[model samples]
Target: MLTPYNLPQDMCMKSHFIFLTLICPGPKDPGKKIDIYLQPLIEEMEELWAIGTPTYDVSTDQMFVMKVAIIWTISDFHAYDMLSGWSTHDLMGCPICMEKSGANWLTFSGKLSYFDCHRKFLPPKH
Candidate 1:
């Protein structure tokens, strides 16, 4: 149910929106030296990737749209810890967030998934 906010201020039962994903590991801290040092290299690669494969500019909807923000290493144990303890309670029903729809839960694992509602936009499900 990982339903992100609707795109273009049109997140109803209809209308499709772009999804933004930061697949890279969440930064440890903005000012961390190790991160700052390795960041540029990763960012460079990401930019090249975006240019090399511009799915966002593609004519077809099913084209690859992933744009990696960066890449960095993380301790396996810490990564596991973060994922295992991750919870969406903090994000759900927050009025400040665009996804907030009163009692709506927009998580990918939530009862009402964006995929479940995908038919409202895009071509009919195959």
Candidate 2:
């Protein structure tokens, strides 16, 4: 979990707000099987969203229902593919483009090349 974005920039990154929920010990990447490991976390998040948990506020010295929402996630591209169920390989590697990606298969190197494909997203004046 992370701190709310409304907090000061410095406070947002503080250790207090950063909660480490789970850690998967592995010598190899989980790949597409990550959902199996995340099932428990997903269920808990769903419960939190639907029916909040009771929490005590230190500053206010009062009790209230606390609900959690996942606003954003940070991960490498490979892990992103695993979490999102998106294939980050071959010509359609670009998640934004999907089928309309500007990737080209290089016959000489036998690889999918994404050179200059990101130019389409640049500002017109850039």
Best by TM-score: 2
lDDT on C-alpha atoms for all candidate structures: 0.42, 0.82
Screening candidate 1 with a backbone cut-off below 3 angstroms (N, C-alpha, C), the clashing residue pairs are 1-107, 1-108, 1-109, 1-110, 2-107, 2-108, 3-106
Candidate 2 residue-wise lDDT, 11-120, digit = tens: 98888877777677789877888777889989998999999999888879999998878988988779888888778887777677887888888989998888888788
Clash number by candidate, in order: 7, 0
Q: What are the TM-scores, per candidate, against the unseen true structure? A: 0.21, 0.74
Off by over 4 Å in 2: 4-10, 57-62, 119-126
Which lDDT tens digits does candidate 1 get at residues 1-126? 122232334563232433232344556532223444546665766676677454552355565645443334333533433433433344332223325423445567566432343344457756
TM-score of 2: 0.74
Model 1 earns a TM-score of 0.21
